[model samples]
Target chain A: MNERDALRALAADLPHAGDDAAVVDDTVITTDMLHERTDFPPGTSRYTAGWRAVGASLSDVAAMGAAATAAVVAVYADADFDEADLDRFVAGAVDVCDAVDAAYVGGDLDTHAEFTTASTAIGTLTDAGPVTRSGAAPGDALCVTGEWGRSAAALRLFDRGRDDAAADADAIGTVDASNGAVERANELFRFTPRVADGLALAPHATAMMDSSDGLARSLHQLGEASEVGFELDRDTLPVHPAVEAVTDDPAERFELAAHFGEDFELVCTVPESAVDRVASDCPGTLVRVGSAVAAEDGITVDGDPLPDRGYTHGTE
Target chain B: MNERDALRALAADLPHAGDDAAVVDDTVITTDMLHERTDFPPGTSRYTAGWRAVGASLSDVAAMGAAATAAVVAVYADADFDEADLDRFVAGAVDVCDAVDAAYVGGDLDTHAEFTTASTAIGTLTDAGPVTRSGAAPGDALCVTGEWGRSAAALRLFDRGRDDAAADADAIGTVDASNGAVERANELFRFTPRVADGLALAPHATAMMDSSDGLARSLHQLGEASEVGFELDRDTLPVHPAVEAVTDDPAERFELAAHFGEDFELVCTVPESAVDRVASDCPGTLVRVGSAVAAEDGITVDGDPLPDRGYTHGTE
Candidate 1:
C-alpha cells in the first residue's frame, strides 16, 4: 500500500482510543510520529526542516504539558547525500533542540537508500501532570498559543521556487517577486509556535495541543478526543503582522493562516474564567478564538463549516 | 564540507567527543546503537523488521540496567521511498516498545533526499541506583549476556545471497530457492541482541555496553570510558552454534564472533566480587573472559593487543 493507506492503518493503533503508545522512563522517554509530505520536504532550509524534525516531538511534550528538555536525532541520509549536507542538517537539529532548551543526546546514524529523518527527543517532564489528547472536557474555551497559516504560505513560496525570501523585510521584495507570493510564503515558514503561552495557561487549560496541522484539523482532533464540537469566531482569528503587512488581502491572509499547516503553535482549551489570566501571561498571546460545543455541530468557523478541511499528511 | 565535517564544526560545543561519535548522556540513563546495515534492513523477515526496529532502540535500555520504558525513533527516508516501508518500520517499532515494556512517547519523521534511520531509546533504571558506562575498576571480571557469533553467521549467510538459506526454516522448505548467499546475508540482519539478559545484569556489572559495534570495539569503548585496559581469553569466547555450523575456519569464525558487527549482546565488566552472582543469576555464562587493567595495556585479547580494530561508524 502507499504511505497514506499505511498511515491510516497505523493510525488505527495510535492514541485515539487505541493503546497509549508512550514510554515512561526516568532517563529518556519518546513519542514517535511518522509524517511524509505532511511535515517537510527536501531542499528546505536548515531552519524549517530542522524545526519540522524536532518541533513535532517537542510539541508532543508540550501537548502532554511537559517541559521539553532533550532530543536524540536519527536520520537516513541518501546514497548520494553529501557529508556536508548531513552536518548542516544535524546542526539545524541541534539548533532546534537548543532553542527549546533541549540537549541533543545520544543517537545512531546510518545511510539508507531513501531520504528520511526520524528524531526521538527526550525531555524532563517530572513535574508534569499527565497532559494527553484525552483530557479536554466540555465547556472549555478553545484557544491557541499563536496565529496559524505561515507554513502553508511558505510551502507555496517553496513550490514556486522563491528561494530568496529568507527574511521578512526582503520577504515583501520576494512577495513582489512571485506576484506577492513570497509575502504569503515568508510569513508562514518562519513562525516557531511553541507557546510559552501554554505553560502559563496550563493551570487553567483543560487540554492542549500544538497545531502542526491547520487550526481546523487540530480543533477536530481536540473535538474527537474531547467528544465535543467547537465554534470559532472567524473575525477573532489572530493574523500575523507580517502576513497582513505584506499582503493587502486581509481575508486571504486570514484564511491561509487559519488552515495553513506547520505553525507549530499550541491549540489549547481553558476554562472561561482563566482566559484573562492566560491573556495577561505568556510571551505568545492566549487568544480565546473559539468555544467547545456539542459533537453534532461539528467544528465551525463563524457559524459556517471550515472549508478545505485541514491538511492531511498522506491522502490530502 | 561533508555531513560529518559540518557536524564536527557545529558540534564544537560538545565535550570530549570523537569524529562520527556517540555520546554518553552523563546521566544515569541507558541508550542503544543500531544501523541500517546491521540491525535494520529490508533483508530481515517482513514480520520482524518493525519489531527489530524497536529492538534496536530497546537494546540500549537493556544495557543501562534499565527497563526499556520509552523510545524515540529518528528516521531518514529517501524521496523515492514509500509509506508502506514506514508502516512496517513503525509496526516493528511498536512491537519492540511492547517487548521492552516502554511506550513510544515521541519521535520525528523527516524526508531526506537519502535513506537513513536512527532510534534513541530511553529506559528507566529499575531500582533507585543508576548504572553508567563508567565504574569498571581494575580487577573487575568481564562478562557477556549471551553468545555473539550468530549475527556474524547471519552476516555470512546474507553476504552469500542464498534464497533458502536466507529464508528461515519454514520458508526454506516451501520456497526452496537455495539462497545460500542471501541466507547468510540475512543471518546477521535478523538478530536481536539479548536485551533482557543485559537489564538483569545491569545492577552488578561495573561497566556495561551492548556489543553493537562488535565485541572488540565495544571493549575499547568500555576501556576508554572506565579508564582501564582489558585482557580477553580468546579460547573462552562463546561461539554460536550457527557460526560453527556455517564456517570452516575456526579461528576466522571466532574472530568474526569477536569482531563482527550487529551482535547486540552486552559484554560487561563486573567486580571480581560479584562474578559469582553474575554467573548464577544471568542467562549467559560469567566466563571470567578478562580483567580490567591499568591503561598501559589497553583492550587486549588473548593477552595480546587486538590484531584488527573494532567497528567505527563512518570510518574503517
Candidate 2:
C-alpha cells in the first residue's frame, strides 16, 4: 500500500493518527522516516541529512502550535560506516535541537544496508490548546511564514553540480567548484522549524499546518480538513531569493514557489482583526497570502483553480 | 564507531543521553531501531516484528519505572511490501500498546530497500521520581521479573526449521510441519515488557534496568552505574520452559538462561526489607537471583566470576 493508504489504515486504529502530531494529554508527539535514496541526493553531507531529518519531525510539533521539548533520532547505517560522518550527523542534530532550545536526547543505532533515519519529537501544548487544521472559518486570513522555494533552489544547484562533474571527469582542479555548490545547497537545505512562530500564533491562528509538502498541497489539506476554501493573491506569495539564483522563467519560479516543498514554514489562518497582533507577536516574518472562503467557493489563485500538486513520498 | 562509542559521544553532548530513557521533568521517552537483517530470522512474520520493535521501546520506558502513555513507530519497507503483512504489523503494534494501556498513536511509513522500524515510547513518571541504574545500595536485593531464555529458544527453533527446510526441499507435504515450528518460534519470540513490574517496584527499588542484554551483562551495567557488585545464585535464576524444551544439556541451559538476551525482563535492586512487599505488589513472578555487594567484591555466579558478555550490535 502507498503511504496515504497506510496512513488511512493507521488512522482507523488511532483516533489522533491523522494530525501533524498526536496530542496525548498536554504532550504532542510525532515521528518521521527518511531514507537515504529518497531524502539525500548525491554530494549531500551527513550534517545536512541529520539536520533535515530531525527538523522534519520538529516541524510537525510546530504545526501543532506546541512548545518544542525534545527529540530523538534512530540512525541506521552500514556496519562499516565512516565514524567522522556519524559524528558530523550527530553534531548537526545537536545544533538543530539547540537552535530551537530543545534537547537532542539519545537514540538508537543499528546496522542496515542503507543509511536511514527515523526521528521522533515531543512538545508541550500551549495554553491555547492545539491549533488543529480543522478550525479555519470563512473570512479568516490565510498566511505563510518566511519565503518559499529554497529547497527547490538547492535541488537545482545539486543537479547543476552533478552535470558539471559529469562533463569534466579528468578535471581534478574543479573539485573545489563542485564542493562550493554542495556547500551552498546544504545551506539552503538546512531550515529552522518554526516552533516559536507556532507558539506565538497558537492563540490567534484559527488553523495551522506546515508547508513541508509545499504551499498548494498544504492549502488543500487545510481546506479539506477545515471544510473551507481559499482565495489567494499570487503576487503576495513570498519567493525565496535562492529561487531567482537558480531560475529566471516566471512559470518555473511559480512552480518552484508553490509546489516545491521542504520550506519548513507554517501555513496558518488568523482572523483579520488579529493579523496585526499576530505579526507583532511572531518571532519571524508572516505574509498574508489569502483569505479563507466558503467550502463551495473552492481554492483559487488569482481567480484560477489551484491544482493540488506537491511532494509526496514515492511508493515505487 | 561502535554503538557504545557513538552513545558515549552523544552522552557528552546531552546529560540525559546515557540512560535507557531520557527523563524530561515528568516525561520519560525512549527510541529503538531494529533492522530486518539482524533482528528477524528466516520465516519471521511482520506481526512479530511490529510487536518486538515497539516492545523494545516500551521496555526502556519500563526501565525508567514510569507509566507508559503512548508510542509511535516509523516503518520503512519496500514499495511493493505485502498489504496484509502491513496490516498484521499494525495490528500487532496496536495489541502490544493495548497490553500496556498505552496508546499506539500512529506513525510514519516510507519506502526503503529493507523492512526496518524505529519506535519511540513516552511515559509519565510516578511520584517516586524516575528510577535510574545508579541508585543501588550495596546490600540491596538483586531481582528479576519473569523467566529468561525464550528468545534463545526461539532462535534455535528458527535455525532448526531452516535446516529442516533445506534438507527436504521437495517435501511439499512438510509445509505444515515447518509452519508449526514457525508458529511456536513466534510464540516464544513474543514477550510482554515489564512495565507493570517496573511501576510496582518503583516505590521500593533503588536501581532498575531491563534485561534486553543477558542477566550477566545487565548486572554488570547496573554494577557500573550504581558502583555496586553482585553475588548471584545460579539455582535461583528462572529459566523459561521453552529453553528446556530446546536444550537438554545443563551447561547449555545455563548459558541460554544467563547469557542469551531479549528477555525483556526487569533487573532490579530493592532493599532487603522491601523484598516481600515488592513480591506482593508486582504483577508477575519475582525471582531473587542475587544480592548487591560492595564494588570491590566483584560480581559472581555460583562462586565463579560471571563474564561481562551479552548481545552487542555488530559494528564489523
Every model's DockQ:
0.32, 0.69
Which candidate achieves the best DockQ against the true structure?
2
Tens-place lDDT digits, model 1, residues B1-316: 3334544443555442331223334332223334544444334553355555556657766666665555555454555556666666677677667655666543434455433445566554565234556778888888776676776676556544434443566555342324555445443455554556666676788778777678887888788878988888887777777788777898788777888756677778888888887678766554667788887887788777864465555543
What is the C-alpha lDDT profile of model 2 across A145-247, one tens digit per residue? Answer: 9999998899888877776676776843343334667789889989999999999999999999999888999999999999999998999999999999998
Error of 1 at B28 (Å): 6.6
Whole-model lDDT values for every prediction: 0.61, 0.87
Using lDDT, give the best candidate's number: 2
Q: Model 2: runs farther than 4 Å from truth?
A: A166-178, B164-168, B171-178
Report the C-alpha lDDT of model 1 over A177-295, residue by residue, as the tens digit.
Answer: 34355434433554553625545655667777777677877887778878888899887877766556445787778666877666777887877887788778777676889898888
TM-score of each: 0.81, 0.96
